[model samples]
Target: MYFISTSSPDEYSTKVDRMIGENMDLTRDLEFWMSKLPACLRALPIIYLSIPGSHNSFTSNISGGSIVSLDSPKILQNLEWIYCIRHIMANWTKNQNVAVKEQLKAGIRYFDLRVSAKSRENNLYFCHGMYSCKVEPVLNEISTFLETHSKEVVILDFQHFYGFTQQTHGKLMQMLLKTYGTKLLPYSDHMDHLSLDYMTSQFSYQVITVYRSDAARFGQPLFWPSASFPTPWANTIDHNALFNFLDDKIKDRKDNVGFITQIVLTPTLTDILFNSCTTLEQKLAIDFEDLRTGWISKQTPGRRGVNIVIGDFIDLSDNLFTKTVINLNLKLLRDLPKRMTSPIN
Candidate 1:
C-alpha cells in the first residue's frame, strides 16, 4: 500500500518540477553525483548503494528504417514487413529517449543492454523491438564517459543476446575487452566486500560488465556472470502488480550481489494495438509517472532495499527518474555511524 499518491500525471510532473527547482543545488551536480557522494556511503558495498539505470539504454536512435530484431515477439517480426506496422513497433519498442553519453551525464550508472548480432553482418546492435545503433559506438561512449569521471563506477548489464554464435560471443567479448581494457572490474566471489572506495581508489576499476551467458563463466573474469547481478523482470503492465512484484523481489533480494528493480510497465499486444497512435512513453511512462515516483521516494538503499532502479524514458521531467534513484543513497547517511562500526560482511 505504498502507492498512496493519486495525483494526475500533469500534477505530478508539476510537483516534480517544483521539487527540482527547490533543490537546484542537488540536481545541478547530477552529472558527477557519484563522484560527489559522501565518503561514508562510498565505503559501503556497491550492492548496498542505490544506483540509477535505464531500461533498453540504447533505443533512442531506433527509427522507421530499423529492422525488427529476432529477439522481438514472433508476431512482431512477421508483421514488420508492413510499412506502417514497423513504425508502430518502433514507437512501442523504444524505451529510452536519450543517448548513452547523455544517460551517463544524467547520473545513470547501470545500463540494461540487450544486444543482437545482425544476420550476415559482423557488427552487433542493441535492440528492443527494432535494431538500434551499433554496439561499438555505444560502448565507446561509455568508455569515454568513464575516462573523464574518475571516481564514478558504471554497471553494464548485458541482459540479453540473440542470434549470436560461439564465435560471435567471442567477437563481442573481444570488443568489450578492447573498449574497456583496464577499466573493467573483474568478477570476484566477494562482491559484497567491494565498495566505491575500494573499486576506484584501491583498484581504479570503473566498469563492471555483466554478461548473461555461460560463455562468461569461462571467458575473461571481467565478464561477470548473470548470477552476479540478479535482475528479475516483473513483466506486467498493471501498476499495482508491478509494485507488489517489486516489494516481493526486494524482500527476497540476496546479499552480496546486485539487484535490479525494473520500474517499468510492459505493454500488452492488445494495449499496443488499441493505442497504436500513442507511443509507449505517452501511453505507459507518462501515465505511470506519479505512482513510479511515489514508489521510488519511499524506497531506501541497502542489502534488502533497492540496489539499481531502472525505468523507461529516463529523461522525463528533467531527469527526475535518475535523480530520485541517486538521492535514495542519501538515506544511508542516517546510519553512517552504525555502519562504520559494523563489519562489511
Candidate 2:
C-alpha cells in the first residue's frame, strides 16, 4: 500500500471508511470500473485518475498484406515489396492482440490512435509500420460501447497522422464530430477542475478527443490540442532505462495537463534485424513483464503522478497489466482531500 507522504493516518482511515461504505470493488467490476468508483474518487479531477491504455491501439488488424504506411521508416517502406519483409514489419508493428471493443471491455480507457489517409481513397486508416483497417468502423465500435456504458469515460488520442492535407484533416474532424456529437468533452484551460462527476453527471460528456495537429486549432472545440496531453515517449529498449525515464518524467510532470507514461520499448534497427523472426511481444515486451508489472504496482495517481499508463499487447498475462493500473486508483482514497480543492465546473 503506497501512500503519499502528505497523507495523515486519520485522514487515510476516514477515506478508507468512505470507500468501504460505498462498496467499491474494482476487480469485480472491471468492465464498468469507472461507474463503480467511490464518489470521492469520481469528484477528483480526471487528470488525477489512473487509466489503462494500449500503445498503437489499432494495430491488431495490421498484417503482411496491408500497405506499408507513409509514416514507417524508409527502409521498411522500400522493402515492403518483399512478402517476408512485410511479415517481419507486421510482427513488429502489431502491438495490441485484440480489437477496440474488446479492449474497452477489458478496462482500457485511453486509445493511442495513429491514422493515415490512403492515396486515392476517401476513408482513413489506422497505421503503425503498416496500415490497418478503416478508421470509421473502429470509431463506431467505441461509440457503441459508450452508448451502453454511459458512466464510463474514454480518451481518444489521435497522436500521429500521415500523408494528410488540410482538406483531409477537415474531413476527419467532421467524421469525429458526427460520430460522437455531444458526447465529446469540450477543451478547457482549467483541466484540473474537470472531473468524472463534472463531465458525466452534469454534461453527459464521455469522450475526450485529443487531436495532435495544427488543424485542431482551427477546428471545433471538441478536438483538444496536443499540449493538453503531453505524451513523452521513453524510446529505449533497455528495461532499466525505461524505468528511469518514467520516474523522471513523473517527477517533472507539468501542471493542469494530462500526462501519458508510455511503458512500451522501441527496438533499435540492429535489434530488430537480429530478431526479425520473432514478434515484438516475444522479443521485447514479454522479457520485461516482471519489471513492468512491478513498476505499475508501485505507482500512485495524483496531479503530478501517473495518469494514463499505456503498454504493448495489453491483453497478455491474463489482462494483469490493465488490472494493476486500474487498482492504483484505490491509493487515491487515502489522499482525497488534497484533490477535492476548488474543482472547476
Q: After superposition, how far is residue 314 of candidate 2 from its true place, in Å?
A: 0.6
* TM-score per candidate, chains pooled: 0.90, 0.93
Residues 129-220, candidate 1: write the lDDT tens digits: 88999999889988888889999999999988999888889999999999999999988976777889899988889999999988768848
lDDT of each: 0.84, 0.87
Best of the candidates, TM-score: 2
Q: For residues 30-121, could you state the per-residue lDDT of candidate 2 as single tens digits? A: 78989987766787788989999999999998888988998988887888899998998888889989999889999999999999998788
Model 2 score (lDDT): 0.87
What's every prediction's RMSD, in angstroms? 8.3, 3.7
Query: For model 1, where is the 10-residue window of minimal lDDT?
Result: 336-345
Which ten residues in a row are the worst by lDDT in model 2? Answer: 336-345
